[model samples]
Target chain A: MSDSDFSILGGPPSERNDESSGGNRTARDDRDTDADPTPELPPGDAATALHRARLYSLLALGLERPDGNGGLEMDDTTALVNAAAALDRTVEDAATAVDDHLTDTAERKKRWASLFGVEEGHTVSPYELTYLPGPLLTTVRQLADIRGFYHAFGIDVGEKMPYRGDHVCYQLEFLAHLCLRDARLRRAGDDEGVTIVVDARRTFLEAHLGRWFWRFAGEISAHDDGFFAAVADLLAALVEDEIAILDLDPEWVPDTSEVTEWNEGIFGAAGRSCGGCGADATGLEDLEGSPGNPRNPGSQTAQDGLDDR
Target chain B: MPQVHNWQLNREVEFPYEESRPERQWAAMFDLNKCIECQTCTLACKTTWTHEEGQEHMFWNNVETKPYGAHPIGWDKRTLEDMGTMEWDGDTYEGDTIFETEDVDWDDPENHPTEERINEDVAGFMPDIEDDWRYPNLGEDETAGEEMDLDVHFDEDTHPIWFFYLPRICNHCTYAGCAGGCPVQAIYKRPEDGVVLIDREECQAQMVCNETCPYKKAQYNPAETISQKCVGCYPKTEDGRAPQCFETCLGKIRLHGYINTPEEADDSDPMAEPTNPLDFLVHQKEVALPLYPQFGLEPNVYYIPPTTAPVDYLEQLFGPGVEDAFETYRAIGDGEEPALEGLLNLMGSTEWSITAFEVDDGEAVGYYEGDEVGRVPITEPQTERDRVDEVDGEEVYRLDIT
Candidate 1:
């Protein structure tokens, strides 16, 4: 961490030491007109692009901190809004790929359905279970929220924006209001792919598979030996790739496996620390870097040492 | 969207909103002074709302250590990624946002692979001491999944008792980032009571809210294909009742009540000043305290710091180490002498302490309680972050000035 990263929000730090690069007091001044000057990618490397996209996306979320007046620079804000719009196309494309791959191989599709526990029967669809209210309503409400965004900067989404059914595509169009996601949607609002895939997912989870899934998955894992675990690992890897391409953190993408882990840990907390711990645990005296543990990720050199005296 | 919070107490309105209409518009206050981190609230929520498959990893209610934050790895530290604070351009406020990213795959259960239990070699039995324990398996060897648990459960770390739990739930903020960030419009705040909720019907399981939220409170439900969080128990509060977590709370630290509009802050009612939702939560009512007011999300949960620790320790957490400053923070936390003095002067020079919380001017004032007399300017934000440092091998007391 650099001195630039220092800024107290609320409460005191958990530990304290003397590492003052530049001690400065700043009054709250809320306005983000300046633009980020970081260098862009040199050329076209999809993986690099993907990685940058991921980091930038994480940064976008971080910008929500109260320090900069609860807002972001106009450039960064537009970039993120645009990214959201573009991701919808990826969603549509992925859904389309899965649906298209399903048509030619009935046996494969059937096996895929059976393996994943898809009880809705074999079908070529994008699924609507992923959006909200209804497929059409997802676009409507999302658009409603973005309306404030447009009004803030005097941008327009044209007439097709309002009352549109394709939220993902419309999201791409909404990016046109800024500039980032504008290129992803082919600049149109016509797509039936994701709407279908998400719907089926909703149906299966809410009605059929939602119940006993945890226990079933658990029992299967315990009995898997290794083959099923390998297959599960492959599927997770594929999905992880998809998420990375979308420039998202694992947490950002909703995955049941991760959520389940969180649920168990949270439940076990016994509601401790809900009211805040009052102990002023002293910061252990500044220790130097450890050469003994090659595995230690936190061992920093003197740069890690902050002298308090 | 950039509206600042108002903390003045307003008395005109009543609390424990109505369910049918979701009309409580009430705020909760947590007395940090009384919190013991029993995590009763966390379990209370899990047993009631998120025991299902997909929600297994989510803690709709958690009380993590501040500076160090919950979920999404280092969320508090990540805030620096935005401004020049983290290694951006320079030392100047250039504005930033909790900018929205891709809409989360709200119902994408395939990507989430699970094992019977945690892999001992990966997440490990003791996480705190190991430091790199992968509770969520964030960063680990590719083959870590090869090892699975043969035991009945995982082991819990034993942190020191000095810690405070910031019992958390959905803030149901008036201007909620989760709701605003949802590409599917799945997360929405009830207009009736201002309790934020996930319209599971509208949510497709795209965890956009998960990314966009600075707090990362919006959780994924694996089995249901939806996201869920505290609706402030609007369903219960609307009916003049506290939510299950609050009702079942072993500590009983949560206070559910409504505040009049900030416009009426000057009126006899409480709940004014710090008009923004966050300031309202952190001060005055003295219920919950801001986990890290510096990171913008502007949470509505407030905490009343416990009195068990030294007055100096409490002073540092709030502001100012002077004698009067100590007295002031204590007074507001007392739940008797009106709003805390630190909360009042910190925000503005307003003498009206009721229904208000002051943050900025909470520096030192006079001598007492074995502390130095006279006031000193509150510590700078940079020093606050410096409070925590990783120990290296070598000589002790090296000042880090990167």
Candidate 2:
């Protein structure tokens, strides 16, 4: 195993030695419970792709709304630093800066809420639609396009995520998934699979994440200068590196945020209400004891045995 | 020509492909009596499936006021005009279908859609993307027949003025016209569920499908350089859930299920064993009729003809079943058909596709793949509140009481 790989997966300095001294279950489990014993790392380009993909996931996790006592985990921070060091010196410095400014979970949680949560009116919008130009109804096609990319690969946002398909975290995670798929395909010696996944990653970065991420980073830097600012700096650096590595020249979003809010009134009265009255037919459920409604008597008796039936 | 039986037309019709029915066909029925012209179904389908740039003109599910409204202006009028005069003899339609309007010999390999002859021989006109699709609501809420009079009170049997909302989606036809008209043969029907699809990789953008699809549903996506239409929400249907439009209907007008031919229709009492609700509504009771069945596609989506519409006008739209359908529907209101009434109540009650349904003890129970997912009372109970109530030693008047 490479020294950088050992650093990226940060465990006790003894975990590296444990590899040579048979397997250390405790240390490996602490990092990844599903870690394969003495796993062989993909060589060269594939290894770099895997590391980059992991960093993308780490960045996505860093940007999500943290729970009351949840912030960037210690191992993730360590991995971010070590992973950045292997990829770029500037990103490594940004990662070191993030480590230097690391605060307690509660403090970072507050910062996240202030920056991206609904409570503060989302001071720095983490949604891609907020960065795109044109009215929301018109520009929503971009959101659909992003979702289309995910769907093309048979990826869907799970119920647990519950985020809009265009949320930055989902976009980032999508890119990470593509890159990870590319690395696995490469390792399996499936040239065709590698080509397909790599092309998808390049296209996604060019179309979505590549266009607006810098604006997102700028918004973070303008609003805060502590842990989040450093993380944003790292995000910008990593994305820049990915662009250069992929040899891409993506069209950047306009510097000014022309955020479009979907106003109900502008579209007219019809848009005012939807998903209305989960009931059908003028609130028939509220109507009691009518002629054709013979089920009223049966309903009273049936309610008791609902579970038994 | 390969002649396939279209029960809707009560005749055999010409089709490009041989007769091959899927193991099961996806079907839906809409109760027109309850529709209020609300476009919730349109938006639901829009937000879910066709929100992209090229899809601006596309409404995979659209509602239009009958007689005067159409998504692509005059879509029905133009197709019907092109087909010339069509008349029904009892139940049999004596008119050329869209496939037969141009008199192309389907049996001849030279006249096949794959032979690049669709431009010359196919029926229906290709709609202008800019002009036709621009006015989805051109005739929305506009009534046909006589103008409104403040004191217009007609008898129970007849009304001078009437209009009803007609919600439309791809019928996912048994012999899809789009599949028949594709020059590259890119369009196909799935053998499992009869969901129609245009293979994007195989589509050469011949655009014949757009011209020949009489319903104007096989729309060309200029951005993708391909023809696109509703895929029947096969992904959801495969998992036994209703399509988005059917699930999101505010009026509970839609019931999604599967249907079989009259001979194969399941007549087993739903209370005794699983029975297809669509078969019961379509084949047994015959309360529902297909939209434009004379088009010869045998569209799977059926409708309960609007009770208030003029019988002659409705006969033109839903074929000769208008009067009979209305009679059967009226029987539900009279409490004569409790099972059917219960099934109507159970429509849109859940997101699951109801494969089987039963009226058990005055309650309508819907089942998906034999697992009960919906149950509703055939008759809803009512309560009347007193006009005056004492609250905290003060008399309170109830303005709204039921």
Candidate 3:
């Protein structure tokens, strides 16, 4: 493997010290680089963090609503396949399934529309709160909390993309953003910055995205065992891997699926109603350059996602 | 124990910390008579500061309907019970304060709190997370005394059964109980404005402040494993702007400014020169009284005791100043205290903090750092209309005319 391609799996120092950038390493060869590495694996942690970030970004882009252009490009698929192979067999298998199921652009677009889009009334919901239980008044706090995480990092939603902060795409993108920060901070040799970003990522996953992602995967898989299903599987596999890596135990959402009333008796159906796009009176505002700071997208100087600080 | 002068008690009170005062104390006054308990202040505070996962139950600004309503149910009643029977000898508190109740010598080196051990001797009960914080507005709108009867006639101050809205926030006391009781000394009063805050980094999650604060403003965040409380909206106050809760008050019941003690009180009346409005209302007019002065924390926030509530109940809550405060409040309506009336009128007129104020040529003018921020009429304009008016050769009775 290239010096930049770090193995995500926990491997021995001897194996990591071997300066081979080959992606065809066995499961036993590619173990955790997240833990404290030997002197030989100094760049491995940074590379691995960036690697995980790329995969997360790919998954986020794949799940988001199609922007007229056909979603999930072949190059992205190739990258995903390579990244997944580096992580574990299960993820690689899921990524291969996604690659195999890549259909025609028009067909893929139509499938995405019917499943996650409004065509089928979002048959497979990509919103985190969809799987969660309780009244909107009670649960809407999570929505605020999600926005708070974004705000704390000075991340705001783009004006054009009005998706809710709790959207699967946004959550995945947030994770990607955190991982990117982790990589950047690691490269800069800022341990404190790395700790903060990593801790934020762990807590955020436990509190928000991690809690409801498996349910989303289940919903998507139950609906159709096709391209979207494979994508869902990829998502599930990546998240499961991360959960294992982080040693997190997220609180799962309820089993039953029910779309709550638009108003939920809060605004009495009089004021502006929620359009299931995370835009409501009590919902998140358009955060301008959310998920990550667009101004300094890649530049990390120890203060990643700590703009407030 | 370190003895500090508590002006509200008009006596020296025992405290854990030495007498170290901020440059200026952050304080606000709420006219209980004008409060509607709309919860706008509560929501504003919630959205501004405490909308996180663990802070779901927290309301930094809560308007509880007293004599029965309380957030975290019986927060005041239970603390008072623990304090036992506190008496007011004239203006001096005759009973033990919250710090003095347990009789733990805070001056002793052994009693000093560290990260390892909690100061269990702090005189207050630790509220259960689930049971105490479950209901934010328990007994909402519930009244006390005799039940209301349809045939019974009552006036503004003559109601047999009564309830008044009591909006609460962090008192940001001169001798802050949270700051005093913190094991690791995580909680501190800002040297600039006296805004008490729990240092998130320094906090060891001992949760001592949660139990020690008599007002129960200090809250534990389970998600972050730290104790949190009102930061007194120091960010806004730093820029000479009112806090979110103060600005969002719909009834115009809140007046935000810095307060001074009676000895250091501002005497510039504002007619000739700029005068501190908070000092004028809290000290000069003596219309507003601190809530539970006998607690001995020397809380900064003051309240104009509700005219409708019973004198005895008001006395217990606001100490012996309730009757005098009510008298001064009534005198303003009777046009006896013109300057006080003008200053009260200036409240809630602007979002900018009123550092100084003046009554000038039939108008109440508010100022922030010598610049005029708000101006309102001392008396709202009124006009008398004729009973009958001729409209297109037809007589029209002006029934709704003032």
Candidate 4:
């Protein structure tokens, strides 16, 4: 590997020298003593972050509709394959899937439209609001918040491009921007810029992308078994790796009761009773008219017992 | 109920209620001959409004290729098919309006078709995204008629296959079918400028408006559970500015102004006293014709039909007056008619409302907010430059001081 590539993957030269010299002070370490307070990341950490950023950029470009010519350039595909391979050996399978599945520009465009475009039965929607459980109107508020984030960073959607603020490709592209910015700041010794970029990345990942991406990926994989499915797999892997790197707790907590309630609400509350066998639980009649009472009657043992009585 | 004159239907139609007309009726005309389908208007409108979630597929200003293009994929064909063929006797059109075509019991809200029924009956199909239609540009740029052979030369007598860009928005009809079809009265036409709007809070998402609108301008926002459409940028228009689409047309093919209604104009010929540029073109010159006037909505938006398109097809779409309108347009293009020069010069006159206009010398001067914002020349000024020549691989350039 070249010196720059080695430094990007392994950390700065001083840190590597310190490690190789068995914790002894090296000539380069003398100069880096003042810079040590900022705490340079290990070479492995830097390499991982760079690799993740590259993967994100690749995915973002891959998902975007090709410029003018229709499909992605061979160079872009090759770079994506290389980046995925660097991340994990298993990613080679996904790279192969992309090559095998998405061949020509026209086929790619058609597949993209079918999967993400507003088609008759689009397999997947790229918007975050679709996956979130809420009234459809409330999605506007979420969109505004996403736009606010973009605006804060001086990034505005092009007037000509009609795309939602929370599109998956856009979100991924934003993350890539943040990572690249952080990398530049690190290299330039701009500690403040680095900190700001890193913090923004973590906050964005935690609040927005990390919230529904796993579920979105699962949905994509379930619906599509082509290049997008492979993309989904890669996305899930990247998000998980990011979460670990950021030292963030697992974001999604699968609530069976919440899911059950949601399903019941949608499909109808038949073959089920309200509330467990507890005296405090609101009765069916009480819930029917009482505005202050909880809408959902958790569990059904109490109603079942009352029926027996 | 108020009786309104629908010139296209050549009869008086009943409105929901009689209300005093706005001081000025907002109107616009687009020249299809100059439109290049750049989509500048579409983007301008999108970025200004409808950038929110649930509005992802909405294109209030869309330019679709005629003959094979439609935002909602056959919006015109389906509505025309349902209404059946229309009859034309010279300049008069005999056809059923949206109100006359199908029986929609507006009084009984519950009996009205549900979203599913409306989708099936009115739209005749469903999009993949539930309650949301896609393919705004489906079959865009696709030409109708037989493919030309590579070696074939053009024949002067025979018409060639062609397509025209049709930039569309809310017509803001005097008698909006969307407003009339809304069971809950969620849709309404403003008494001020005759702009149509949907009240989101009151909308029950019955989607009857979507189904009933012949133009299919009313869109169902599934997330919002309401039908929304082009509000005609009333907020901007009220402030003496034009709609986003009108303000940003790159082709300079749009003209915005207020036209005197038949009831308001003192003269029997409304064109006799043309206070604004729109009045001059739509009334005096009669170059621009309303699209599908037979629908009887009395749509405010007008169009200058493409000269290259078949005359019969153009007549079928715009009425028999289309031939006259085309003749006037051709005369204006050839600079043979000075009477229509001011109207042609007013195309893309100003970004704001043109309250007054006058033709001076060869330029059409438009007054907006009591200030002259535009002076469109009847003939654009051209500058000639001498070409540089190379002699024996040496560049020879000619320089002109004046």
Question: By DockQ, who's the top model here?
Answer: 2
Tens digits of per-residue lDDT for model 4, B1-402: 235677655676543333234446778889898899988998788766776556666788888777655666556655565566578766556666655554433223333433333422232222223212334554466554446778655563224666688999888877777765565556655545666777676688877777767777888775678888997887677677888888888888887777776445323221233256666667667788888887768888989998877666676568777778877877866777654666556657677777666666776667775677777776777777656767899988868612
Candidate 3 C-alpha RMSD relative to the actual structure: 17.0
Q: If the candidates were sorted by their lDDT against the true structure, best first, what order would they fall in?
A: 2, 3, 4, 1
Q: What is the lDDT of residue B399 in candidate 4?
A: 82
Q: In candidate 4, what are the lDDT values of residues A201-262, reduced to their tens digit?
A: 88788878888788878777877787777777777777777777677664562321121211
Stretches of candidate 3 above 4 Å error?
Answer: A1-309, B114-118, B383-402
For model 1, the superposed segments whose C-alpha errors exceed 4 Å read A1-309, B1-24, B66-69, B80-162, B266-289, B306-326, B332-402
Worst 10 residues of 3 chain B by lDDT: B130-139
Q: What stretches of model 4 exceed 4 Å from their correct place?
A: A1-309, B1-3, B14-20, B103-132, B151-158, B262-274, B338-346, B384-402
Model 1 / residue A306 / CA error / Å: 10
Interface RMSD of each: 20.0, 22.5, 24.1, 30.7
Give candidate 1's error at residue A38 in angstroms: 67
Q: After superposition, how far is residue A87 of candidate 2 from its true place, in Å?
A: 6.2
Instruction: List chain B TM-scores, each candidate.
Output: 0.53, 0.95, 0.97, 0.85
TM-score result, candidate 1:
0.37
lDDT (Cα) of model 3: 0.76
Clashing pairs in 2: A288-B381, A288-B382, A289-B381, A289-B382, A293-B379, A294-B379, A295-B379
What would the TM-score be for candidate 3 when compared with the true structure? 0.64
Docking class for model 2 is incorrect
lDDT of each: 0.36, 0.77, 0.76, 0.64
